[model samples]
Target: MSNEPDQQSETTTKTNKPSIINVAVAVIHHKDKYLLGFRNAAQHQGNLYEFVGGKIEPNEHAEQALIREVAEETGILLNDNTIVKLGRLHHDYGDKQVSLQVYKIELTVEQYEQHKYCEKGLEGQALTWVSKSQLLAGEYHLPAANKTILEWLKLPSTIVITYPLTHFEAQSNPKGAWLKYHQEKLASDSWVYIRLKDSDSESVAEQLMKDRPDILVILPNDNEQYLDDKHFSTTGDTKTTQQVVAKHLTHSTLIQLFDEIGSSTASIQSLPKDYPLIVSCHDIASIKAANQLAKARLNHNLPPIIGAFLSPVLATQTHPDTPPLGWKAWADLAELADMPIIGLGGLSPTMAEKVIMYGGIGVAGIRQFHQ
Candidate 1:
C-alpha cells in the first residue's frame, strides 16, 4: 500500500496537520530470515510489526542514516558496502507524509555469529527474526509500509533474452555470440528464454538446452518429450516469434481457455497460478490487459503474473519505428500494472539502477548481454 493511491486508508484522522518524515528502512536479511521489530505502542499505529530503521536526520544521506539506525536499534553494525537497494516507498499518512528507502543488509559469518543474539527489545519494542515463509503468510500483519516488497523479494532482478539468429545475421563473432552469451549469462541467477524464431528453432533449442539445461526454452504450442523441466509452455499463441516468445495471455486466449457457456463470462480465472509466467507488454493498453487478466486470476486464488517486459523504454534498432515510452511513461504504466515488471529494449545491466528507481523490478534485453 506504500505507493498505491489508496494509501489514504492507512492515514490517521489528523489530515489537516502537515509533516514530512524521511525514513531509511533496513530489511536486515541473513539467509532465509529477516529482522523486524515492533513499533512503540505509544506512537501512531503502535505495536505493529515492521522492519528495523529510523528517521533520517538533517544533512545525513539515506544510506548513512540506515547504518546509524541499524547500529542504534540493534547491536549489529553495517557499512555502505554491506547494503543493497531493495526498493523505496512513499506513504501519505494524512497529516504526516513519509518517504522510506528500503535496503537489505548483507552480513558476514563472523558478524552473524557475534550478533545473532545481540539484539533486545530496545526502546521497549520487541524484536524477532522470522523466516521467509512466516513473513509471506499474514503472520506479521506488517503495516502498510511496503506491501509489494514481498512480491519483489521473491523475483530476480534480471531477465536474459536469447539473440534470435536472424537479428544477428549482419554481424559475427569468434565462437558465435548467441552460444557465447548463453555460456556467460547461465552463470548468473537471471531467467532466460531462447526466443523460438530461428529457421531451425527445434535444433537451436536442443543445442542451447544441451549446453545449459537450466534456461527456460520457449517453443510455441507444440511440446516435445525431451522438453521435460526446460519447456516454458505459454498461455498465448506461437504463430510468430514475438507472439510466442512473449507468451501473452491475450483476453481472447483467456476466454478460450477459461470462459464457460451460460451465465459465465470471459476471464483469465483459469490460468495456472503456480506456473512461472512472463508476459510481454508494449504499451498502456497491454499493461491494462495484463491487469485485467491478473484480476481474474486473483479472483481464482492465483498469484499475480511473474514479470512484464515493457518495451521501447528507449528507441531501439529492434523496433526502430515504435515511439519511445521513455522513463516517465514506463514508470506510470508500470505503477498501474499489478505485478513486478522489467524495462526491456535498449538497456544494459547498468540500467537496473534507473529501472528500479522508475518502479520496475530490473532490466531485461536481447543484445545487451550477448555483446
Candidate 2:
C-alpha cells in the first residue's frame, strides 16, 4: 500500500481552529473513461470512490504535488506540460475542510493500454475505470466535493453561444431559423447558450427548450426579465423551465447580485441549489465576485457556478475597435477564476483544444456557431 496519507488527518494538524487542507486532484482521462480508486474503509470519507491524488505538501506547487502523488499512488507519471487546470473547489465536511486543485490529463493510447489491466493501484486500493455516462448517472459513489468536478467534466469542450435575433432576421423565417439553427447544434454538440437580444427573447428561449428537451440549454439571465425563472422545478405538470441545466449571468448581472445580496447567507438562500449558475467575467474583480458566489453556494452543499466565460480572447470582426485580451492576458485572467473558464470572442469550435492549453475548458462564440 502507498505510504502517503489521506487529506482528512493533515487538514487539522496545524491548529485546533478550522484550517483548509490543500489537495491536488487529478482527473486522468483515457477516451471517455476516468481512472478512479476505491478508498479503504479506514480513511476519511473512505469506503467510497475517489480520483487519484493526495494532499499538497506545504509550499509545494499544486502541479508538482499532483505529479508526485499520482506517481506514488498509480505508478503513472504525469507530464506538467500536458496538465490542464480544471479550476478548484472547496468543501467542508464539518469535521474538516478541504480545497481541491483540480487538473485534467488525457492519457495517450499506450498509457491507457499500460494501465488498463491494473485492477489495484500501487497502494493496494482497488482501481476502476468508470465511463462518463456511468459516472454522471450516479452508478458509482463519490464524495460531495467531487460532485462539482463531475459537472465540469460533463461540459463539452466546444460551447455554442448563439447570435442575437437581429443577426438572424435577414433569413426569410427569422424566428423559425433561429430556433432551428440552435436546435441543429445539438446534433454534434451537447450544450447551447441562447443569446437572443430581442423583446421576445424569453419566448424564443422557451421554444428552443420545448423543441429539444434533451439539449443542455443555458439561458441568458442578464436582466430582471430573465431572473424570475432562473430557478427551475419539475413539480408542475409541464414547466418548460425544467429543461434548462443552467442560467448565464453577465458580468453586469453578477455585480448587481453581489451589490444587492452582498455575499452572505442571503446569497445562498436566494439562489436555487438545484439549478447551476454560469457567469461572464472579464477581469480580476469580476472573477473574484464570481468565485465569491461559487464559494457561498458550495458552503451550502450546493453545486456552484459551473463555469465563467472570459471574452474577447481575440479581436472580433464585429468589435474591431475593442482590443482583445490575447492569449497571455486571457490566461492571466483565467488563473483568477475558480470555475472552468470558457474562452469567448473570436474563437472557433476548432480552437477548443488550443483553449485548454491556455487554462480554458472550452471555447464559445457567436459567429462561429452560425458558421
Tell me the whole-model lDDT of each prediction, alpha carbons only: 0.60, 0.78
Tens digits of lDDT, candidate 2, 25-72? 999989898998897888777778888888888899999999999899
lDDT of 1 at 171: 61
Top candidate by TM-score:
2
Best by lDDT: 2
- After TM-score superposition, the amount by which residue 58's alpha carbon in candidate 1 deviates from its true location, in angstroms, is 27
Q: What digit string (tens of lDDT, one per residue) describes model 1 on residues 125-198? A: 57777888898776886666555456556655666677666654756652266566566656443456556454
- State how far residue 254 of model 1 sits from its true place (Å): 8.7
Badly placed stretches (over 4 Å) of model 2 are 1-9, 13-15, 171-173, 183-186, 227-242, 259-263
- The per-residue C-alpha lDDT of model 2 at residue 164 equals 68
Report how far residue 99 has shifted in candidate 1, in Å. 19
After best superposition, candidate 2 residue 28: deviation in angstroms?
0.8
